[model samples]
Target: MNSDYRKPLPGASMQGEPVDFFDARQAVEDISPGAYAKLPYTSRVLAEQLVRRCEPKLLRDALTQLIERRRDLDFPWYPARVVCHDILGQTALVDLAGLRDAIAERGGDPARVNPVVPTQLIVDHSLAVEHNGDDANAFEKNREVEERRNDDRFHFINWTKLAFKNVDVIPPGNGIMHQINLEKMSPVVQCRRLDSGAKVAFPDTCVGTDSHTPMVDALGVISIGVGGLEAESVMLGRASMMRLPDIVGVELSGRLAPGVTGTDMVLAITEFLRRERVVGAYLEFFGEGADALGIGDRATISNMTPEYGASAAMFYIDDQTIEYLKLTGRDDEQVALVETYARHTGLWADDLDTAEYERVLRFDLSSVTRTLAGPSNPHAHLPTSELARRGIAVDYPRAQQDEQAGR
Candidate 1:
């Protein structure tokens, strides 16, 4: 939004004072009174980011493109942040360090080079399983192995902590990066002070180095995974330019039957979505089935988004989200902010019944049974009873003979 169109946040401030922000609600309302809430969660987050940062010349076109679902026109999106596990994070930092040396060699101020946005790396990728699960000291033993095995890499990671700005490192054995993000790193709503002395409230949108990054999207964040090179570009404040994706509304109805866990449901849904050729689509799940699921249940589905080849799997913020925040030990005030911001910005699940999608597929959770996924493909749904037919329960000697005969 232009300066002339900016409005103050009702309960937000930079320093105990009111703050002005680009009123995304007003912008979409200018398009149509009922337009804002009808946008999919993914689309709403994308629109807000564009409204906040897109150039004046390109702003209207971009917003119109998204509002109308014009897949023909491409647009630019600036993620609020970037997340990474040690494997990619370490490499990116090393590249930056190398770049710094190259700059110094060119008589430039090497120290001036740093990430322009918030970047966090968790040392989650490597750890030796030196202790078995039955051991009482398993976690400690694992940590010991991790520290010893990754001594050199950890040294470099520690150096980067002091060597660079706008970077935070979470030590190994903390948890998986996706789990850490879900449990702590990601704030469902982000509040930041902009250069104009305004504190803006927006979704916690991000891109990670692992595809399962969408796990946080269950909390209403617009998170997705990108490769290291792409992640590096985003870390340096580059816009992720792209054409609009096919946003598929997956209307989940009915409840899961007895013995049908959330995992079974996800496997079933993944198989269903994959079969529908939902590759690269943004999937938004709604209806009584989706609403009945807790945040953890939603996370199980979102975490496996890549398994079905979809770009993101998102659930709109709702009471489950609020309850989850409190259960996870988030401060009371922060939890309240999430609700207020989501409600006001048209991102709340209750506000999205009218959301529109050109293409849609429906799945019945009740039809989902106790399932076994696969020996290979994640979306390959193999019923436990058919394990033998799928060669998963084959006779050992027969299989060995067949293998020896090169069959």
Candidate 2:
């Protein structure tokens, strides 16, 4: 960690005192006056991590890329954690064991090999649903089938949990991995103690083994999906190399119509973003419409990020985020820490009023109607009203005739 940017974090600590934090906003401003205020939310968070973790020699250049919005040079990003499902998680652990064997053969201590980053492996994907949902005991029956079928796999997975350091295993039937990460796994902000006996707080960032990992982005955490190999590398303590991405600003305006569900709005937004060609871009959503959305509603949009071809769909840390943290059973002290850190570090939603974006897309929430996407592709957006015109819907008489004729 660079000492130059380190400063005291202003917040009531768990012991009722201030915590230490890296002052990224001040560091950015010192280099380029007034530039930090103009950075989008994503940039600000990236800058903070750069300040906290980048080598002192490379710090300036890395931050300059963010300040100038340049993607010319690759910078290092150290994710706070890694999330995985049983399939890839098992493969990664097997690779680690192989590496340990190789190390022992080379006269090195195999015991020293362990993941530097914390990893959580959830067995949510391997379960088979043997019983129908209508059955009252379907969940239990399905779990039993999963246990029987995946006995060997489960044994290996359970062994990994005990054999590996920094690995936490959530056994099968816990919940969907993404939803678990959103509501329980991610802390929104993380605080740690250094070797020198000082504490520092930073925003939570992670890379998951699944595409829908960006669901935590709704909580203002910078989470993204990675391939199995990349996830393995990160687990082994390698920084994920990245150049600054095309950060696009999406300004949501107006409120949703009464009775409109978040599903409809997300489907509409997904189609709109895909049409605008947001492939591989990091999108920051803000404005009156975004402020009005609850964390659940924001998560609805963020969960479809890959379908819309965006890398991350991020929101700012705001009151809704705070409320959601509370509703999800987070401790009051931790919730206060999140809000305090964000506000002090210029990551709060209100602090970003002056943030500027290179490309701004305006979307009206009220314009969204009941919608559906994809008979085949998720991007195939069709409002309910257009279904008949598009020949996807038939009149009652035609439907009856087709049903009778079995056509």
Candidate 3:
């Protein structure tokens, strides 16, 4: 461990003072302290902000409002840009089209309503690799299949692209949205020139229609994946309201075993965390174990935020973060700015002690074995040896004959 690395950060609180900013200690009183141990990663991040930003009266008000009145509260959410892959993007648009018709029937202009925030829709995720590995024509064949199946959806998307404001379309044949986000999008620290001619900086936060939006969390952006209905509400400038959540600090120890891809590690972690029931909490991955993983590996874990049912899987600012920013073509100045801001703001991994989570979970990398999850859910782990017991390995020659004879 670096001696100078793990110091308390300055100006770490939203109110600029340390006053038990989400009252993790107090909130745990109403519920069993042990219950806090099970919150998902997403809920934890939200809890952190509610503690830091919500006014005291509003804090109690906000907490009770939803549970008591069930009313939605408007809070500030500034997503850098809305990201969508083709499938969900198309479905979301279909809903919007329905909404337009509903508005027209109510004597409102259908064309007048639009996304209030900057939105980017990418045509990825519809491509399935029916063809095998890296053949010269594989990309072409895949594109053909994609275009054929998605023609109706594409036609609507084309209309949407021209009809809507604040929307940009990245056409098909591009890579996955998260990969593109890492490669080209996501300015680690966003800067906008204010009307007074001074530059202002705030944390980058976003909500994507897809559940994997947390992939960008590896870059220190506060992002969450929401359902289309929830996203539509957010798009219309509504605040997502809620009570404070339990933020769980996951202390990872030891490096991953060799030949283990980030995917494998994340799969293992996903199963373990799900069994632990950390749904809706914010999970911060830190320690020597976290420091050792490459940014790509961190992203793999973060990308599965939905699989583990956590809100955000965050890896704090560190040397690996800086390296990823550079590798992804971020400007040198912006990269330096990220380090400066994080170090100053206590957002850095080292600055996080007395960082105070409602709960904590620990994991050891060495104990994870080669495994696979699912006959259904990603969290359902079915060891290979159990296949026979699960009936997955049964002889099917007679079953095939019965099906052919319609018996």
TM-score of each: 0.90, 0.93, 0.70
lDDT for every model?
Answer: 0.85, 0.91, 0.67
Q: Which candidate gets the maximum lDDT versus the true structure?
A: 2
Task: Kindly report which residue stretches of model 3 are placed more than 4 angstroms away from their true locations once superposed.
Answer: 1-80, 91-113, 128-135, 195-197, 372-407
Give lDDT tens digits, candidate 1, residues 220-241: 8889999999999998888889
Rank candidates, lDDT, best first: 2, 1, 3
| Window of ten residues with lowest summed lDDT in model 3 | 1-10
| Candidate 2 residue lDDT tens string, 1-407 | 66777777764486565678888888898889999999999999899889988988898999999999988999999999999998998899889989989999999998788888999999998877679989999999999999999999999899878878999999998899999999999999998777987777888999999999999999999999998899999998888999999999999999999878898898889889988999999999999999999999999999999999899999999999999999999999899999999998889999999999999999999999887876577666677888788798867788899899999
Candidate 2, residue 345: CA error in Å? 0.5
By TM-score rank, best first, the candidates go 2, 1, 3
Model 2, residue pairs in steric clash: none
